[model samples]
Target: MSGCCGPAPDGRYSEIFDERFASSIARRYRRRGLTAPEGRIIEALSGLGLHGRSVLEVGGGVGELQLELLARGAAETVNLELSDAYEQQADELMRASGVDGRVTRIVGVDLAAASDADVARADYVLLHRVICCYPDFAGLLGAAADHARSAVVFSHPARNLFTRAVVAMSNARMAIVGHDYRGFVHSPEAMLGVLRAHGLALRTYERSKRWHIAVAVREPAGVRTAPAG
Candidate 1:
């Protein structure tokens, strides 16, 4: 997710994501595919064709993932973003890929608070690197599950001592700068529980040194229940 800081709630995230990371992240995407953990996420979803399916990418950073999904046969894709700095660069990338019109970008909205009527449930929902960006893990995960017609996939910082230490340092910097933007290292089991409450079952799990990937699928009506650990 691209973070921002121009007078919006948690705008500091936008500032950090845009001014500090968007350009470099965009450049990396243009040269390669997604970064390691994100690449793993793409691999998981690529096998699932989007034919006539609606896809929503929450906190889509440079807008690369949505295009990839669209090109793979997704009917239409929507991006809910927090920052505008990535707008121009993302637009350029979309144009260059010839998928400029395939996406709908909504800026400055909190997807966690998004209503079902406001944002229709999608066949697939992605939150690549988004969890660490949000303060409320359960709300965000639950909302993503509710908004997903079939599956919801997300990337978050791996929960561990080292990761916690790093996040603590990052939060300290944000505080020192007087920014409300902060990072979190949430428990994977608790996050899974939130999705379970929303009727999604954990289906796939993968992890790297810094990031972890999890996919939750909306179960069949009669068989709706989370898998036992």
Candidate 2:
């Protein structure tokens, strides 16, 4: 929601992912842990041997996913956020989880528009439910792939009639409420095309009724085989 949510008068997009929103997400995470799609992402990344590797997560609200990855053996994680609203909740969660030293949250940084030098490269890049928030999926995914040394994993709304209609309704409601935030159902093929162009090949793809989990990895030299999931 970082790249998609428009800033308010105070220059923060606190209207959406406000303190209450962050606390709600944190409380839900503490009670229920990762969601289904989030679990699938962790399962995929686990197969890559997370021990000692680093992660970069975009729009990681409350830092739940990063905390889980850290528990699963990832060395360090960086979260690039657009709003400062989630910081307090993220900090409290980190402290409560005893992972205060491992996770780094950089607020107000938009990965889509950041330069190569502005962000650090990591072994894996994660974007869970983030693609739908950004209008320029290409720019966002391209930057994700560019920052990934091993794999780029993401989740997006499935391209189907029901999903498209739902997104349209959501956007309409946001407009009606005078919110600049909107949702999009970008073409999965086109999104994958953007990643593939950056030397990442589709490795594992999983689909649910509403979301698609796609994992694309950078293959070693001379490996021309494609992955089937």
Off by over 4 Å in 2: 1-13, 221-229
- In model 1, residue pairs whose N, Cα or C atoms come closer than 3 Å (at least 3 residues apart or on different chains), thus clashing, are 3-13, 3-14, 4-11, 4-13, 4-14, 4-15, 5-11, 5-15
Per-residue alpha-carbon lDDT of candidate 1 for residues 126-189, written as tens digits (9 for 90 to 100) = 9988888888988888888888889999888889899999999989988998987888889988
Clash count (model 1, backbone only) = 8
State the displacement of the C-alpha of residue 194, model 1, in Å, after optimal TM-score superposition. Answer: 0.6
lDDT of 2 by residue, 1-229 (tens): 1222223222325576788998899989989988888888889999988999999999898999988899999999988877678888888888888987888777766787787767889999999988998899999999999999999999998899998899999889888989877788999988998987788999888989878999999977676444323
For all candidates in order, the CA lDDT equals 0.79, 0.84
What is the TM-score (0 to 1) of candidate 2? 0.90
Candidate 1 Cα outliers beyond 4 Å, as residue runs: 1-10, 226-229
**What clash count goes with each model?**
8, 0
